[model samples]
Target: MADPQSSQLPEDELTVPRAPLNKMIKELLPNVRVANDARELILNCCTEFIQLVSSEANDICNKQAKKTISPEHALQALDSLGFGDYLQECKSVLEECKTVAAKKRKASTRLENLGIPEEELLRQQQELFEKARQEQAAIEQQEWLQLQAAQAAQAQQQGLHLQPGMQPTAATGGHFQPYQVAEGIPQHGAVPSLNQPSSGAGQLPTESASNQQIPPS
Candidate 1:
């Protein structure tokens, strides 16, 4: 039967969930059938038991000027409430929990887990950085050379002369050679005048010719 006082407590105070309580009861008494009212009674009793222990532990904590309840305080509360027969088992469980927690903390802080010494790690990082820097420098140098070559080629194509070192190939559409005249072409100063006749053609008489040939005329 459920306790009258537990039944009178507010729903919010019943923190023990019913489903786990019902499951536990079934596991403990598989062949025996339990009523729903019995299950409700068990649920309420578990909640009341937990509340009683926690309240006593809180009081013990306050008396010791502590704001939080530790596991020791809970154990003390259980002993004070006349459950000393369970103390040894609870202490063993608490020690096991603390051992597991310490192992986890130690594993988290161990430097050996990284598989490399600090100096070796730093050396590897420096090597990677140097490799990347060298690659970047080489790329920039190649790009600069390409730009200079392009500018030189453009100048040559525009008929501007360049030094031997700066000359580009004909494949780049540039002509760097000096200008030349073709064969059989006359020089600028040796060209003949159009107003003068050829030497073998009939000629007009000059003033000297008129003074000599007048008797024959």
Candidate 2:
């Protein structure tokens, strides 16, 4: 028989956590309360049991000229170590693990399982990318057109509010220029020149006006 103390790892080097050990102890004894020392001893025993099983599994693997100890070797080690009563439960757990692993493998290869060739899948992906790019470009173009329309509307609104005689000019640094009056056109509110004759000022008195004046005398 191996020394129990020799198989025990140091507290600092313990792989099994105390919290899970405590929970398991509570679950197994439900209403019964366990002491701290009893919990520590159970934790150490669990770790030692794992080390013993692993060593036996490794020996069984080496006897078969294998470099790695597989699940089968572990089951065989349990039986050889007089723990044959756990064999059925361990097998059931092993089967559950295998089922989960199979599902993961299947999920990882779903695309390949679809039966589509790699080249076809790549071509379809490229087509989808091209369609997305075209849609984005069209959206950008529509936004640009809407922006141009808004600017044009703003310019027209501003033009309607301008003074009648003012016109926009590029030469005046984006300012308005007053409309220039043409020569010979009379300006509003200007005084007439005294030296310039009016339309009837140069004409003599009419004949009828001269005859009427002699009669009155």
Compare the candidates by lDDT and give the number of the best one: 2
> On residues 85-161, what C-alpha lDDT tens digit does candidate 2 reach at each position?
99999999999999999999987799778989889989999999999999999999999999999998888776745
User: What is each predicted model's overall lDDT from 0 to 1?
Assistant: 0.79, 0.82
- Candidate with best TM-score: 2
* Candidate 2, superposed: residue stretches over 4 Å from native: 1-11, 111-217
Deviation in angstroms for 213 in model 2? 99
For residue 63, give model 1's deviation from the true position in Å: 0.6
Model 1 poorest 10 in a row by lDDT: 178-187
Assess every candidate by TM-score: 0.41, 0.44
lDDT of 1 by residue, 51-107 (tens): 777877888888898877899998998999998998999999999999999998897
Which residue segments of model 1 deviate by more than 4 Å?
1-10, 99-217
Give the Cα error of residue 100 in candidate 2, in Å.
1.7
